[model samples]
Target: MEDILKHNFAAPNQLATIYYMKERVEDGRSYYTFEYGLRTPIYATTSFATLQVMADSLKILQI
Candidate 1:
């Protein structure tokens, strides 16, 4: 089985962040991995709470 979760958040100053997660099951075992990234025009800063919220909102689909 395999599952994926993805989300994106946009902040002020043309800053954007993408969050991704993947889950896989093999041999009766489950594994997971996560990735996140940020994009900006030049330089940008965001609060930790905002990033946490974005991370918290991710949900992997069941299949």
Candidate 2:
């Protein structure tokens, strides 16, 4: 839902995106990451509530 909403509102030919990656090492160490870009977010975490707000706001555009 979030992805579709973002793409609908994103700049032409520039869709919004979110990325996550994880890596583990032989020493049992691990890393996690989250990445996203497009609309401005009120918080760093970019929770679902924010996405819903964005979606609702885009509805005004009626695209």
Candidate 3:
């Protein structure tokens, strides 16, 4: 959505945004033991791809 792109996807600033999203989901967001919420896999996959791009950019800079 536009909100995510504007608020969380800015270059240089998106690194922290992506990191925090991953951390929050991993550490705080609870998953049901027997069930799960409606997860749009396409959204999850796209977000991950974006994060991967960010990480790869950082790695290239370190070389």
RMSD of each: 9.8, 13.3, 13.0
The Cα error of candidate 3 at residue 51, in Å, is: 10
Model 2: ten consecutive residues of lowest lDDT? 47-56
Alpha-carbon runs more than 4 Å astray in model 2: 20-35, 39-49, 52-63
- What's the residue-level lDDT of 35 in candidate 1? 52
lDDT of 3 by residue, 28-60 (tens): 333211111122423322233222233224211
Question: lDDT, candidate 3, residue 17?
Answer: 27
Worst 10 residues of 3 by lDDT: 30-39
Q: Estimate candidate 1's alpha-carbon lDDT, on a 0 to 1 scale.
A: 0.39
Considering TM-score, where higher is better, how would the candidates rank from best to worst?
1, 2, 3
Q: So what's the TM-score on candidate 3?
A: 0.18
Residue pairs with backbone atoms closer than 3 Å in model 1 (clashes): none
Task: Provide the global lDDT of candidate 3 against the true structure.
Answer: 0.27
**Candidate with maximal lDDT:** 1
Which candidate should be chosen as best, given TM-score against the real structure? 1
Output the better candidate (1/3) by TM-score. 1
For candidate 3, give the lDDT of residue 29: 36
